[model samples]
Target: MNKSEMIDAIAARTDLSKVASAKALDAVIETIVESVAQGEAVTLVGFGSFKASERAAREGKNPKTGAKILIPQTIVPKFAAGATFKARVAGKDE
Candidate 1:
């Protein structure tokens, strides 16, 4: 669901109002982004972990021209779902 829909869900599931829920969600997202950008990992049990990963430089072809190009190395964000989350998504968890 989108942000407003998610905010509605959070508000329904908690005592917080929509404004508070939105702020909380925004805070959480900002914190995760900041942590990963700083080369730190953030883990939420039964959910997932977010971290920064290195990508090596590689050669790639331009799709339109079919010309070879060097893709520069970079740091990218990564996420690995927790086992419980995986199980739930796979319908193996109650």
Candidate 2:
């Protein structure tokens, strides 16, 4: 679901107003982003963990031109779902 729909769900589940739910969601998102950007990990027990990961430089082919190119190394955000979340998504209960 989109942000608006997610906000509605949060409001419904927490008895919060839509505005309040939106702010809460925004705060959570901002916190996660800031933490990952600073090379930290944020973990939600039953959800997932977010962290920054390094990718090594590699050679790649350009699809359009079929030319070889060097892909630079970079740090990127990564997420690994928690056990509970994985179980739930797989239609099983933890």
Candidate 3:
């Protein structure tokens, strides 16, 4: 669901007001983003982990012109779902 919908869910599940839920969600998201951007990994049990991964330079073709180009190496964010999350999504009992 979208952010607004998620905020609503959080507000309903907890006794938090919508504004408080939204701020809490924003803080969580900001923390995760900052950690990942700083080359640090963030892990939450029963959820997932976020980290930076290196991508090697490679040759690629431009789709429109079919021209060969060198793709520069970069560090990109990646997520690995925790076993519990995977299991839940797969409809299997943990």
**Highest-scoring model, TM-score:** 1
Runs of candidate 3 exceeding 4 Å displacement? none
Candidate 2's displacement at residue 70, Å, is: 0.3
For model 1, state the Cα shift of residue 12 in Å.
0.2
Q: Indicate the residue-level lDDT of 30 in model 1.
A: 100
Clashes of 3: 0
lDDT tens readout by residue for model 3, 1-94: 9999999999999999999999999999999999999999999999999999999999999999999999999999999999999999999964
Q: Clashes in model 3: which pairs?
A: none
The reply for model 2, stretches above 4 Å from the true place, is none
1-94: candidate 2 lDDT, tens digit per residue: 9999999999999989999999999999999999999999999999999999999999999999999999999999999999999999999994
Tell me the lDDT of model 1 at 89. 96
Top-lDDT candidate index: 1
Q: For each candidate, what is the lDDT?
A: 0.98, 0.97, 0.97
Q: Which sequence of candidate numbers ranks them by TM-score, best first?
A: 1, 3, 2
lDDT (Cα) of model 3: 0.97
* Residue 14, candidate 1: C-alpha displacement in angstroms: 0.4
